[model samples]
Target: METQLGNGPAGIRGDLSATDLAKALRQGWRDFAARPQYGLFFASFYVAVGIGLYYLFMVRGETRWLIAAVAGFPLFAPFAAVGLYEVSRRLEQGLPMGWTHVLGALRGRGDEQLLLMGGIIFVGFSFWVIIAHMIFAIFASAAGLGEGMAFLTSQMGLTMLAVGGAIGAIIAFIFYAMTVMSLPMLVDRDVDFITAIITSFKALSANFAVLLLWAVMIAVALFAAILPYFLGLLVVLPVLGHATWHLYRRTVG
Candidate 1:
């Protein structure tokens, strides 16, 4: 059965244009420039964690951990974005920015709505990890593949990658539809997480074409950013994070 939309602080969803994507990027760049300190500060956390994960998996030769990290990291990205939402909110409202305010936004009024959203992200990530492991086991076992670099070169490994990538894309789209506006909505209003998610989904359905393009742009940009040992995320994460706020603003009215 289809679930009904929640009675939250709903708004009319605006039609998104390709030009709006460009405008959002420009505005996001402006926000980052106006407050590079906050952008850099928040970005540093993501870079540090990413680098730490790299060192653990690459340097320490913990490939299993790397698999889990790679599978799960994107799920947590929306939560990390709360900081950027706060920055954009402050910028839009002409509110004063500071360490106290930015950090306090992370506290989120001790709101359980954020916690509920977080739990959903966690569960989604956990499910992906399990599925990834299963795919690996099944394909590798069938092809008599061994661990380390050998599996990567084997036919089984290629098949696993193809299948996993397809599944991961589906999962990513689901999460994106649920979160593309929900997090910012939660931060900007008093709505519950369920309502925010439903609203986000509605917005996506209303403008699936343009929003899908935006999603593709985000994925490509992020992939390019991470290729540089995660250092690029110091900039890419902030820009995209802020842009996401602008996107949410335009989409949700």
Candidate 2:
């Protein structure tokens, strides 16, 4: 019998190459340039959120919220990319590129599967924040270090950072494997969330090296984008979001 996941048919998996990364980036740039308004419009949401978070944490002195937001920020990227995916999809299909069309795609036909996937992302982010808090408590107490930036200047703080970084990497890779293509697949097809996630894992397994490289590139780009008060995300996020759609196209038949 043919493989099936949930109520939807399985997706066909394809091979990927390092070169595809460059190609996807080029196409993503083209798409962004072709529709600068949409790219900026979608990206502005992320910028607004970033600035809002900064205002809450720094200006208003909400350190707890800051910790949670920083820990969970990565989880927001895939969801934010949904609009860019729609934009690319429309561009690829030669469909109308109006705000109504692009924004309406966000409704996603009331698809529960996309919501399911989003729930998973949120859960993963919540888990990470909890883990981060625990790690902070354990290390900070042990080292007699106080909370906030003071910890970073001490040995215990450095150790905590190291341990947290290692753990965060593992979690991030697992999430990346699960959703790298699943989001686009979810938007592009009628597949169940589970199937889309499984297909994403299989694609990562089959093309581990290239996909890992792609993941690393994404991480590095995001880190750099975040350094400048998250303003850089205005450009970086949309490009990466559009590139991801092309990458999904190349990886899934």
Cα TM-score per model: 0.91, 0.91
Prediction 2 global C-alpha lDDT:
0.82
**lDDT tens readout by residue for model 1, 1-253:** 3322322234645466899899999999999999988889888888888888888779877564576666556667778888889999999999998888887777665778888888898899889888887777777678775556788677777777888888988998899999989999988988888889998988888778889998899888777877797788888888988999998888776
Residue pairs in clash, model 1? none
lDDT of each: 0.82, 0.82
lDDT of 1 at 26: 98
Model 1's number of clashes is 0
Model 2 residue 167 lDDT? 88
How many pairs of residues collide in model 2?
0
